[model samples]
Structure formats: structure tokens, C-alpha cells
Target chain A: MNRIVIGRYIPGNSFLYRMDPRTKLIAMILLMVSVFLIQSFIHMLVALLLVALLLVFGGISVKRVYLGLRPLVFLLIFTFLFQVLFNRQGDLLYSLELHYTVLNLSIAMALVIMWGFTKRFLRFRLLYFLATVAGVFLLFHYLPFGIVLGEGTFSVYEQGLSTAFFIMVRLVIIITLSTILTITTKPTDLNLGLESILRPLRILRINAEEIAMIIAISLRYIPTLLDEANKIMLAQASRGVDFQEGKLKDKVIQVVSLLVPMFIISFQRSDDLANAMETRSFVPGQKRTRLHILHWSGLDTTALAFTCAALIGVILLRVVGW
Target chain B: MNMIDIENLSFTYGGKVEALKNVSLCVKKGEWVTILGHNGSGKSTLAKLIVGLLKPQKGTIRVDGVELSERTVHDIRKKVGIVFQNPDNQFVGVTVRDDIAFGLENLRIPREEMIERIEHYAKRVDMYSYLNKEPQALSGGQKQRVAIAGILAMRTEVIIFDEATSMLDPDGRKRILSYMRKLRDDGVTVVTITHDMREAVQSDRIVVLKDGEILKADKSEDVLKDKETLEKSNLELLLPLEVLHGLEHKKSTNEEIKEFLWQLSLNG
Candidate 1:
């Protein structure tokens, strides 16, 4: 529950940190759009090069970059596997044959069980996952102890592999770009940038300042309320309320018992917050000053112009079917 | 002139029940006043009313010579800040620095000055290093200090602590009381609303409230020594301290009082 990968900042002295938050936000969006415009190997290579350049300039080590992608490893693998196995539009590069027998199946199951047991005890989990896969495949191929239950053959296509590779690369680049943005930018600075971006909404009679204040306050309270919920859960657990293991009906009741108190406390908290805000002389939608004044320097302008040009170039590439 | 002056103040919570009834009180400038009451005795309500968070249905409440009303409430709030009870709920910023700037932003302070005041007040409260820290990363006492810093940054002449130390530990309570003493010494009017008798004993004046009415208002020693009125308001007297005060007013010493108490018990 505590493993939040995004919106977490690490203090550093780097060019990205010096850039205006608005510039970073806009540049990140533009980069994401350019990433999606990749149509062939050339575009993919270009995008990969840009992401690598950003990684270097971000002052983040390769290990930290891998750590950033750790949470999405499963999704990346799933996408690759789904594309390779299901999408067959090109000539077959290789034919794969498989047999399922009692001996091999049992051995595979044992390997899986072993992996699960040793997962927490191991440090290099990616290597463990790969090792387990190799062990299962070798067992299925070389060992034959009982009657074969089933046999099948599947073909791997050239196009499917290419497409999967492109997709996985795109996802990693996008996620890594976003991770860099969140790491470099402060949350308060991001809020200020969002308010600035949403300033034109004032023409629609929507107060962007009030919306920003709401978002800021909500972000401020998220950890606090989560702690409160944890406390409530523990208190309920001590009272013989089964939260983790119970019948479905009993679990639902337990959840309700937890949620009702949380809701009551949140409501009372909102009341208290409203009164406190009033006492602080906060009037929503009123003209108020800010503490961290965002200055859009010439360098920030140049950065945004560069990203905008990159976005336009990518769009042109897509339009020309490159 | 009184820092806070309330006359014939009456407040009902949207016609639910009367929280304060015809309450009248005067707090002198730079006075450290503690309002003592049990739960539901309208102590918090009075704090809110003075800060203009709640309107008095039938009375005039003035702060720093300005009457609190719809037109002047904002100005009054700028002059009189509050440190509420709950540290989590009242935290309006994502970080200590931002939270302290919250009130300054509302007051339309310039960016440079806001930073200066935030640093000044945060240092004063010993939270300078926690400026970039989130409220969740802080203990209850630290969060309270940040909350107080937020109020102090507003440069309010009068500060109200509405049961601010109720949720803290002994050390936290003592730390906050010392800050209160410092603020009063700096000529800032401090009104602390609390149910702790020990805290009331340290204030410059004590105003005991009962059923939304001021039962007794006197100097701290006088009010805490008045066992009859304090008991009527569900309060207690620090008897040993009172006996010492009795000696203060006369030529008696601690040994003599001990001897007399021993004789009385023997006779009984």
C-alpha cells in the first residue's frame, strides 16, 4: 500500500529542477505525444535516443531508472506476450511445439511453488522469474515419464515480434519520461503550474484558484486520511472484526463498520477545516497572492519551444506515413 | 482598551441549541487569558465568535477596537488568528513552508515577504528544518507547532488557541504553554481555551464558563483559589498551591501551614 511510484520527489540540483514547472509539464506532454507518433524503426530509434538523453540529463543512475520501471515490468511483459502470441500477420519465423504430460506438468508446478516460496528470500527477482521460466521449459522438453495429455504447435511471426518490441519500447519511454518529470518537479510547483494552465477557464466562470486550492488541500490530507483509515482498521481488527479473512457477507459488514467511522470523521474534519480556513481569512475565488512565484525564464521558453517543434515534427512524420 | 470586547453575545447553532447565552467579557491588551470549561461549555464557540467564524445573533464583539461583522470580519480575521484543536484537519498546505504561507497568501502578502515571515515564524517555533516536510511526516506536537507558525505568520495581534494542546502529550502541552508565555511577553494578546486546570493556573487571568455563561472572571491566582466557584463550574482547585497563595497574602510559612493542617486532622 505504501509503494507509490509517481508524484514522489527527490531533491537534486539539475537543469530539470531549474526549469519552470509549467515548462516541464508542457514539455512532458509534448514528448508523450511524440512518443505515440512512432510509426517505424527510425521513429522508435529517435524516441529511444531522446529518452536516453533525458535520462542522462536527469542525473538519475541506470539502477534508479530500472527501479522506476519496476512497477510496470508486469504490464510491459503482458503487452509483449499478448501481442506476440495473438497477433500473427507476417510470415512464420519459427514453429514451436509443446507437450503436456503428468511428469512434466508436476515438475512445472513444483518449480512454480518453489519460486513462490523463495520469491521473498531472493534479491534479483527478475532473474528468478527468468530462471523459473527456463526451468519449466527445459523440464517440459527433456522429461517424459507419463502419457501425454495433449500436444500443440504454435508459430511465431516476424511482424508480431517487431510490433511487440516497438510497443514495449514506447511504454518504457513514456513511463520513464513521466517519472523524470515527477521526480524533478515539486508537488506545490505542479499545482501552481496546473492553475496557470487552467487560468483561461475564468472566461467560463470557473474559478481556477478555488479548484487549485481544493486540489492542494486534498493532496495535503491524503496521507493523513490514509493513516486514519489504517488506525481505524486496526481498531476494528482488535474488536474481532475480520478484515482480511472472513465470509464474503461478514467481510462486507466489516468493511462497512470501518468505512462508516471514516466517513463520519472525514465529515467532521471537513467542518473543522472550513472553519479553520475561514479563520485564516481564506475566501475562495478572491484575489490572493502566492508564495513561490513561478518565473518563466528565457531558458524555460526555449525548452518549451524545442518540445513544441519536436511534437510538430513527429506529427508531420505521421502525416507523411513515415 | 480591551483587545477583545464582547457584550450581550448570544449564539445558537442554526437554532439547534444555544451555545453561548448573553455572554459578556473583556480581554485586556497583551493579557494571557485562559477560558476554562468542560466539554460543550461553549469555549470553542466563543473563540469562533471572536474570530468571526460564527455570528452572534444579538451582540457586539470587538477586537482591537474594530467591531466584528460581515464587512469587517475579514479584517478581524487578519488581526486575530486561531490555532484550532485538530492538527491534521487544520493543516491547509502540503508542506510546512506552504502551510505557513497559506495565511499570508490569503492576506495578499508579497512573495518575498511571505518567505521571510514563514522562515521567521517557523524558526521561532523550531520548525525551520521541517519546512519542506509533509504534515504526515511530523509528530502531533510538530504539526501543532507548524499550525501555530501558520497563524503567527499572519502577524495577528491577538491569537486564540482553541483547545490547541488538548490532543498533545505533557511535553507538547508544556512547550505550547511556554510559547504562549513568550507571545504574551512579546505583547501579543493570547486567549487559550482549554479544560486543563493546570494550564489555567499559569494564565494571567482565568474566565470560568458554565452553561455558556461566565461564572467567574478574575486574576489567575484568585480564580484558581476560588474553590466554590471553580467547583460550581466542574473545575478543581490546586489546594496545595492555594495554601501557598494564602501564605503569600500573610506572614505564614509552609511549615506553619503544615503544622496547622496536621493539628486539624489530629483534632478531627
Candidate 2:
């Protein structure tokens, strides 16, 4: 079977694809910090606009971002409603009978969040960033962008729109960076780089070799685990396990049933692994050679330099009280 | 000196079922010994015991002069490697190269040495090209070959194959059997536990097992000629018997009548 490309990686050779994973990871961190530092509404708008430009350049579809955010839409709405109703310090748009606090959906907080998302989109690829931009644009166009609903007479549509946009933005940034990292870097190099960066933990007596082994195994097992889960689900479905006919509680139980067989299969695999290792005269704590060696190239250096620059810029902007 | 020595060795599971009883066996260095039996005839149990995977309830098992006990079992295990029947179950590493390196790692071999040994053994098993391929993605034969490489990389002087080829296709089975013969020729003690009569006939010594006991231990010719013993043990015979049965009957041989049975039970 051909390799699966489920995550955000589009499998291309663009500049983003050639960057080191460590660089991409640091860039994500820098972008996240920059999101919180911009104080002026115009600065936030500029950040958002930069994100839009990035989305276009990255060639990611807007629909992908929305799809990534689809699962979080509910939580986004729930949080938005909670924030607007409970945050009573702002100018009262409406008052709820349940409490003396005025429901002030703070426009500043909402706009800051939106601005934060725009910066994220700029940092990553286009697919999800575009989706989020479209979702938020449509949301602001319809919903009285900053209207707070009282408890007795809340606008579900307004809450949904606000929540969806926030969620879409977060989803777009995380998915974009994550996908970009995975696509740009092989699993082996990524783990090795992570191990090298984490070498300071050697003071705690942590074995880097063992940690590397665990990471390699876990990464390798992800697909195997997914395959096993699918098999178990199908097998349970054949046995009349009604996965679709469940409330939240029933669905959880159905999922637990699938875990039983997956655990069994994994345990069996581990036992086999133990024996296979024994046969190979493998001794723990022994030195080993790696067949594939990953070196930091010029591209890696440039990528890291670019990420460092971004971080430094964010710190500078904050110091200047931007 | 015998490479493997088993004297009055008996193994019981959970102190209830006796898997092997009063089993005494000896194999010279580089000898190829095949244990033949029906399912649950204690062949697998004995193989596990020899490799220190299971402790003997009574008596002793020694490999390369080191006794297999709680104290020395670890050392014995390092010297004696066993390939199990299921290729899928025996893979330690996700990929062929990694799996082959597993045993070497356990032995604390240096990184450079492990790499050198992995390359050599993988090449020996003809799996050098698949060193990077996922073990789960390989064919049964390829998987078995990788397993063999995993064991061989450890450089165990005594290797036990516990129905290692049973799950393999005919080609895979043939490939492993030939490899076993080659290993035996290279002065490695090779013990094969199998139900395949054809494989048994090719061994230096054939030990028939039944009901947790050794029924017969002799040269391949002697064991293959015993049709009565084969019938009692629920095993079929192989080779020359099938040809002889066809000649005597002037008709097609009975498909159910095993090849070995044709020699002793053709007219009975």
C-alpha cells in the first residue's frame, strides 16, 4: 500500500518543506508569543493581514482549516458564551436574571484572539489558515461581531459564529505547523534532534538512548495502533457492537470495548519482540550504531536563524511597548 | 564435548501439567538434531526449556558446558537462540534492520560492532535490501528470513528452530531449511523442532516425541522406517515409502497413508 498522508503535510519540496523541524517548532513558539504582545488594534490587524499573506503563499486550502476546526466549534461556542456571560466588568450590553453581573462580551478580548489567530496563520501553511480566515470573515460579517447575549435571551447564532472563528484559527495554526514539520522532516531526524536538544536531562540520569528508542517505537507504532484500532472496530461492529447508536456515555463504552482487543494485540506483539530480542543477543545498555545519519545542512542553519530572528523580533516589539 | 546436554530434565507448567518427563538428550557440537512430534507432544516445550525460556521442574540442561539454571540461565540464553514458529510474533524491532540489531543491543555490543554484525547477518539471510522495510510489511518468507537474521546477529553457537517454518509458504520453508543445513555445516549446533516429516528425514538425528515422552531417538533412517511408531504418534511418513507403496499397489497410493507408512504398512 502507498503511504498515507492524513495530516497537514502536502508532500512538496517548497522552502517550508526543506526547513528543519526544530526551526519550524521554534517558529511556532515565536509566533505564539508574538500573538499576545501586540497591544494596538492596528498591530493586531497587521498581524492578521500577515497571516493572510502567509496562507496565500503556503497554498493551503481554506476548507482544510475549517475542517480541522470543525471538531472544536462546540467547545469554542461554549467558552465564548461562558466568557461573555460571566465577565461582568465591561460595559453592560445586557443583564441576566440569574446573576447581578452584566454580560459584557469584551470586544477587545475577542479581537485580540482573532488577531492572535491571524499571526498563527501567517506562520503556517494556507490550507487551514484560509479556511479559518473565511470562517472568521463570514462570522464577523453576519453576527453583530461583539454582541453579548443575556442568559434568558441569548443568541445561539452569535455565540456559534464567534466560537467557530476562534476555534478555526487555533486549529489552522497548530495543524499547519504540525503538518509542515512532519512533511519537512523524517521521523528519525526529528527524534534525534529532539534527543540532542533534550541532552540536558542527562543530569537527571535519564538515558537518552532509551528515550530515543521509546520515541522511535511510539512513532512507528502510531500507524500500527491505528490499523489495530480499525480492525478491532470492524470486528466489534461485526459482533453487533452498536458504535453509532450511542449517547456520549454509550459511545465511550463502545470505544472501551475496542481497546480490549487492541491491548491484547499489542501485548502479544511485545512478547514476540522480547523473544526476538533475546535471540539477537541484545543486551540493554549496550552501544549501538545508527545506519542513517542526519546532519544539519545549510538549509537547517537558515531555518534556525530565521526562527531565532522571529523570536528576537517579538521580544523587541514587546520591549518597545508595541 | 557435547554442545547441549539434557539429563533427566522434566518441565511442568504451573506444577500441574508435565510438558516433558525424564528427557535425556545429548548433541555434539555442530550436530543437526530434529525433534518430530504431533501437536502438544512436548517438542515446543523442550525447545523452550533448552533456550531457558522455561525452567525444568527436575534435572538439568546445559549449553556449551554452562548449566541452565536460574543463576546461569541468562548466560545460557545468550549462547542459545531460538526462532519460534510465528514470524510475526518473533519480530522485536519494527523494521528488519532494527529487529536484527535488537539482540546485539541486549548483549551490550558497541554501536559500531552492532552495525557491522547487522549488515553481515542481514546479508546472510538475504534480507540486506529489506533492512529498512517494515518487518510487518514483508512476506512470510521474508519475515522468517529477517527473524533468522535477528537470531544470527547475536552469534549464538546453538540455535533452536521451534516450528519456525510452519507458518511459511513452501518457498519460505525450503529457504529456511536450507539455511539451517548451512548453519549446521558451519559448526553451529542446530536443533529443529518440527512436524514436517520431510524436514525430519534430512536431520542427522530424529527424535520422535509423544505424550511428553521421547518414543524414539535414532538416525533418520531408523525413525523414518518405523511406520507403527509414526501411526501411534499421529505422524505421517515421508519419501521412499510413498514411491514403494505406489509400486506395490499398481494403483495410486492412499493420500491419507503417509509416505513413511507405505514402507511398513503397505499390505497391512
Provide the TM-score for each candidate, comma-separated: 0.84, 0.72
Tens digits of per-residue lDDT, candidate 2, A1-322, equal 1244433234455666565665666666667666555544565556566656655665655565555555555665556556554544434454323211122234334554776556554644344544554454344433442333432333234344443445445545555455545655666556666666666888998878678777767666666667778778888889888875657898998978988878888898777666556445545555655554555578768766765776677678778886
Error of 2 at A170 (Å): 3.4
Of the true interface contacts, what fraction does each candidate have? 0.94, 0.45
Measured by DockQ, the strongest candidate is 1
What lDDT does candidate 2 reach at residue B160? 90
Docking quality band of candidate 2, CAPRI definitions: acceptable
Residue pairs in clash, model 1: none
Error of 2 at B106 (Å): 4.3
How does candidate 2 fare on TM-score?
0.72
For model 2 chain A, give the 10-residue run with minimal summed lDDT: A95-104
How accurate locally is residue B264 in candidate 1, as Cα lDDT from 0 to 100? 45
Off by over 4 Å in 2: A1-168, A237-257, A286-289, A292-294, A297-301, B69-78, B105-120, B239-268
Question: How many angstroms is residue A179 displaced in model 2 relative to the true structure, after the best TM-score fit?
Answer: 2.5
lDDT of 1 by residue, A78-145 (tens): 79878888889898987767778998999899999999878878898877987898688677667756
CAPRI level of candidate 1: medium
Task: Give Cα distance to truth, residue A97, candidate 2, Å.
Answer: 17
